[model samples]
Target: MSLDMSLEIEGEIPDWEALDNAIRSVGVINYEIDRDYVFQGAFKKSDGYFWLSKRSEAQRKTVIAEGNHGCSFCVYNAIVFRINNFYYDDFVEDMNSFLKKLTSLSSMQFVLSFQYEDVYAVRNKRGFEFFWDQPR
Candidate 1:
């Protein structure tokens, strides 16, 4: 079991430096990003990893074509994190900090799962907005 967090980016594209800083801030390392800025790597804080990727326009269309009618809310770019079920407290603390950092970098739709309960939110210059008192 793991906690999943997805950030759908909006407006300007995030630069590698910003992404690197965010990823490192969460205790992730030895990652690599392609020209498209898609990246994946393990977390130094625990037994988990993350992947950030963007779908091409054609790919998004294909998902729609395949019958995911709600795909409209899905964006071309997203950063997804998979935190392993170990040291839940540490993960929550780290993610709280990471989410706060992200707010200053970009505007995004944030989706997070806590104990299998998912909550949708928006992250902007103001901050991350959602409520989930995850059990430790």
Candidate 2:
């Protein structure tokens, strides 16, 4: 199955270099980063998952509000991680593990979304825009 993973980070990481290092440490194939989000390209692994790590208070608030109230900020962040196919249970487990590791090292609160493929910004009737793709 094809798996697309998106990781969100708020604030600056003192060890920003570790971001790529951590992902590499996971041994996944086709990993790519664009701005603040990291996308692990489609993988054939049994299971897959993505982590949204919030390093700042603003980022944490965004996650909580989006999760609890469908906040626009959350909707925008959701656009980056889109997959074209369904995943198996193993994918979910692996994703959770990845998230756990990121949070443990970064001290950032994270939210986990499993087997989600629909891109929110494009699909939403409201035409929400993703943070990364916004015109400068």
Candidate 3:
């Protein structure tokens, strides 16, 4: 089974010439970043199931982009990305913290997962963070 994680943020994404810039900025060494920003050797490198944005071109345009920017992925959001099924917490946390530091505007998050369930980390107008579950 493959596990997926996505970082969803709005506003002020840090400029990175390559995905390596972001990966290195987070201080995770030993993982190779490719030109596509796809997972190369982090986890499950031998398995084809562990692929991010596995959707076809037409499918990705419809499903992932949601008509926003015409199937192009924004750095602020990573949808359906592949990672180790059991060992993705560090990745998620690091991504969250990395994004939070890019701007002073604060942020919120909505994550839907089949294994971990749906989680929303919301940053309110008061500049505080809160968590809630969806589909209640």
lDDT of 2: 0.39
Stretches of candidate 1 off by over 4 Å are: 1-3, 56-74, 106-117, 134-136
CA lDDT of each prediction against the hidden true structure: 0.56, 0.39, 0.36
- Candidate closest to the true structure, highest lDDT: 1
Residue ranges of candidate 3 with Cα displaced over 4 Å: 7-18, 36-55, 62-92, 101-136
Clash pairs (backbone) in predicted model 2: 47-90, 47-91, 48-91, 49-95
Judging by lDDT, tell me the better candidate of 1 and 3.
1
Q: What is the C-alpha RMSD of each candidate to the true structure, in Å?
A: 5.6, 11.3, 7.8
| Model 2 Cα lDDT, one tens digit per residue, 62-119 | 4332222132333223312434345555554444444445544654332333233222
| 10 residues in a row with least lDDT, candidate 1 | 61-70
Off by over 4 Å in 2: 1-8, 12-16, 34-40, 47-61, 68-80, 83-86, 114-136
To one decimal, what is the Cα RMSD in angstroms of model 2 from the true structure?
A: 11.3
